[model samples]
Target: MQSLLKNECSVLVFTLSGLNETMENRYVLFSLTALYYPLIVFCNVTIITTILLHKKLHEPMYVFICNLCVNGLFGTSGFYPKFLYDLLSHDHVISYIGCLIQIFVIYSSILCDFSTLTVMAFDRYVAICRPLEYHSIMTNQTILKCILYCWLAPFFSMCLVISLLSRLTLCGSTIEKLYCEIWAVAKLSCFSTIVNNVFGYIVTLTFFGHAVLIFCSYIYLIRKCRKSIESRQKFMQTCVPHLFSLINVTAAFMFDILYSRYGSKNMLQGVRNFMALEFLLVPPILNPLIYGLNLTIVRQQVMRLLFSRNKCDE
Candidate 1:
């Protein structure tokens, strides 16, 4: 009888220990998801709504901002709900198809974001550098074509990369992080990921390289504008928002590179968390604030919108 009781006690202890570990991991994931997702949703929604309703924000610049907000919304929506559920339910297993979908959404958003920013920089360059031809160069049809290309180019690129990535088979460790990021899941694949890694590097170089060039072009344009005192003040105000947006985009790319290169068993989990925050959380929060505070038109429109809403409530 004593031997039987001792065996039961051992079994219970082992089970409790396993449960404790699971609970601890779930707690950590839940905290992270809660911290980042709400802020992302709020900021994206604010930017989208503000641009859509405010007639004053119907210009090319705000149109690009609206596109960016939409991209952020889709990107966050793709991963955060499932991530939150996985954390709360302690079910970290994502199926192959699900993983592929997450990768598609993430990469598509990344591509669109970079492409949109490139177009925005080009728009700024044309407006400031070639003021005489700004209207002719940025006609509605031309802007529409640019936006379409930005959307379609990234969609196809991500689809191709994901198709290749999906061919690889994952064999071990069904439990991933709160969400199924491409590299995180790829690490568990039984097959070689050399092609995927190489393709990822290519994608990074293409998108981020273009972003850097666009940023430099804007800086050059700003330098030229600074010769005139009035134009310099206006240029600074306009450039500040773009600079903030560039920082957000660049930091996301840099962190992605770091995560891809050094993410192994030896890598610190905190580093991964930091990368996620920079990539997923910071931009959404910062973009609207940057635009709203720096752009006088947007601030006035936002105030008007709020006032109209308050009056309606009465």
Candidate 2:
């Protein structure tokens, strides 16, 4: 009891042990991250800028793509900057409050990805399935509401998580992950974390429900598009990118989930690190590339923007 009280009161910092075995290669890792992080920023920013600047691309689909890119930036920001810093530092530690903030930013951004994709699936459903009512149903105000739902829902969900986390009395101050994670921190709690665990499972089910919803919608879309070449082309042009992005994000999230729940100390740290970093590394860069390069109009507009900027420089 005395030790518990002392631990509970003294837990102010968390030592991150994920990098302990990989410090020998820190410089090489830091150099690569420095290069890769900027590339992610540039790609997402280019997609966002192209959508915002062109009046013709102001439709719901483009706007949602822009929101997606913005979210990619938001989510990656929660991890990459701090990760780069940690790679160079001898001590890998985070404050108690910092850990909570990291958990909120990282996890909320992930939930927001699901929310945005859910809204995008709905938009595609309306556009392809109910073509006549596409404009009417996806009015500017409605689009605004969808965007708000994407952001606000995740924000509130994570807020509740952070609130619950703050109430726990932690007996340990070491997290075994590269970044502060909610489950990792919760595992350190001195008492039962049944509430947090239940809530976490609920949140997981809700987001995976989003995936199921998107899959069902795509089934209907595939059936409807099969009847007409025009609709088929539309599906190929638009829905394919969204589908690819959904699959990529889903796979990455699954990797992290599996790693978090089943990863063992006996396993190699590099493989474990790869699993944890997959979502952060791939989805941010891949989302923009998938959308920008796959969508004709977005590709054309990006090229035109680059050419025009070059001409101005000349």
Candidate 3:
């Protein structure tokens, strides 16, 4: 059994073949990434720093927004550095342990986005639907718990899936994407991956169900908003941004999930790669902009900080 186990587990480093066709454009890709990644960092970090520095913005809703941006930074840290290196280097490979770590960081961050959005949806529901109870309900302890839930649940789930993947005897060392992902690695297993498939489905449905609940909550909120102009204005200002974020993340994740499971091989590699990358690329940039533009207090503070800094410079 030991000898059989050793024989089956032969893979040491995974050669990422996703960059094979794109090598000719590596420099261009590298240049674009060099410019783009820091922008992602800039956007997310600015939002996070803005929220933290301002005392007035320390409320539950803004706190949650700050957490979302922080998760964006966490997710991209797993991919961007390695991806940039791969773009420069001739060989695109990652060690088994490195691959597992990448999968854990990126996917958990994505899941945490879902969890954060869900919690934010609930925050809005309470604020709009039950204004009198918002403070009592969304207390400091509740915020801390929600933050913990956002981080822990996905971490635990991905840790379980990675533990399962680690136990499997992999027969291949070539990953088809630029970055490591759970399903990509699981597909390389020599034995039946029934457990992995089952768990993947469970995780998908569980988070997607979070999306469902968010939608339902909005449905009721919108109905309530219709009766009062004040409520209608609040919904237009605050809830609309949340709704945009929810839709952005959902669509991006859906593209990734569907493409991973059922994507056509005939599709262009660039298209496939884009589908894989959309979640990481879009949301990090979009969420801050959405919130920054819409949320009155945050926008006021941001603009105030910017203009104040200009005065200092002048």
Cα lDDT of model 2 by residue, 1-314, tens digit? 99888998898999999999999999999999999999999999999999999998999999999999999999888888989999999999998888888898888888888999999999999988899999999999999999999999999999999999999989899999899998898989989999999998899889989998999999999999999998999999999989988998888888887788777878899998899889898989999999899999999999999999999999
Estimate, for each residue in 1-314, the C-alpha lDDT of model 1 and write its tens digit: 56544433332110001122355677776787697788777766776788898777788888887888888887777777876775566434565567678778876877787888888888888877787898899989988998997899888888878887666555544433445566765665566899988888788788888778887897798788868776677667776678678778788868765765665645455555556546666665677778876788877777777788899999
Q: Which is the leading candidate under TM-score? A: 2
Off by over 4 Å in 3: 1-7
- Number of backbone-clashing residue pairs for each candidate, in the order shown: 0, 0, 0
Better of 1 and 2 by lDDT: 2
In model 1, which range of ten residues has the least summed lDDT? Answer: 11-20
Model 2 Cα shift for residue 90 (angstroms): 0.5
lDDT of 2: 0.92
Model 1 stretches with alpha carbons more than 4 Å out? 1-36, 173-176
Worst 10-residue lDDT window for candidate 2 reads: 256-265
User: Would you list the C-alpha lDDT of every candidate in the order shown?
Assistant: 0.71, 0.92, 0.91
Residue 274's lDDT within candidate 2 is 92
Quote model 3's TM-score.
Answer: 0.97
